[model samples]
Target: MAISLHWLIALLIFAGWGLGFYMHDLPLSPAKLRYYSWHKWMGVTTFILAFLRAGWLATHPAPRLPRVIPPWQTRTARITHFVLYLLMFLIPLSGWLMSSAKGVPTVYFGVLPLPDLIGKDKALGDFLVQVHKWLAFGLAALVGLHIAAAMKHHFMDRDGLMGRMVPFLKSPRL
Candidate 1:
């Protein structure tokens, strides 16, 4: 369940990121409006999934670091994971805030109309656009780091660490 949620959220985030970049350059038109709606929908889904993932993690703790791994490495992993979770929650929220401030209603699936977090203000919306963009970049970098670390553990360290999330890589070596 945890791994499923993790991958689902990751997929949505990356998809949204790509869609956002593509849509950003497009001129005002029906296509752009449609893309924006899709992007907002993805953001809302990711936000909800993050909450479920967090709740699952809180109730069911993640696996412990192997003693073979250095203490500092373990600490760094913990910190990175904490921040990643934080970003998962924050990025979508920032987007919602940006939409709200820009006077755009975020209708989840074109059916549910979410209330604005704050009153419409162009200046604040502009600021939040920057905030959301930077937060996305930050999350992307961290995701890269995470993948690198996982590969290191799988190949270099040969610890089968990723096996926790990937069933085929079950950790007999551990």
Candidate 2:
């Protein structure tokens, strides 16, 4: 069976989310230093997988929304999907910029040298950091809504919409 690009991208994004949270809560120490590398990896991984998933989606569009679902629900799903992709890319890009602005050299998995996109401007760095934080919060809320809606479809509506995205789930009729 072919691997689901969606699943791969989703997992990588989840890793980014986890690492972002951890790194946000810690000071820059050895213990915190450990999370930095992982955080960087997660960000890089998310960017890569998001690209791959976008390519896959371009080629293989998602299945149609449930016909029984309300029109507003369908619109919400579309908007949520748009927000997910937008923030998934934006969050990592902002993090990379914030790091660069702080004069933090980024290394991708300790091999390739990632470019420092921003100069050493303390003001710019602080601004980007705040932007990153707010964007992350927005993305987190969107993700929560998406997951809750999926759960609602699966349990309350007994629809197979969630199953399409969650590959491990059995179809409702099965």
Q: RMSD in angstroms, all models?
A: 1.9, 2.2
TM-score per model over all chains: 0.96, 0.89
Model 1 C-alpha lDDT per residue in residues 61-109, reported as the tens digit of each score: 9888889999999999999999999998899999999999999999999
Write the residue-wise lDDT of candidate 2 on 32-86 in tens digits.
8768877877787777777777777788787788799999999988999888988
lDDT to native, each model: 0.94, 0.81
Instruction: Report, for all candidates in order, the number of backbone clashes.
Output: 0, 0
Give candidate 1 regions above 4 Å deviation: 170-174
Colliding pairs, model 2 = none
**Candidate 1 has what TM-score?**
0.96
RMSD of 2: 2.2
Off by over 4 Å in 2: 1-3, 171-174
Q: How does model 2 fare in lDDT? A: 0.81
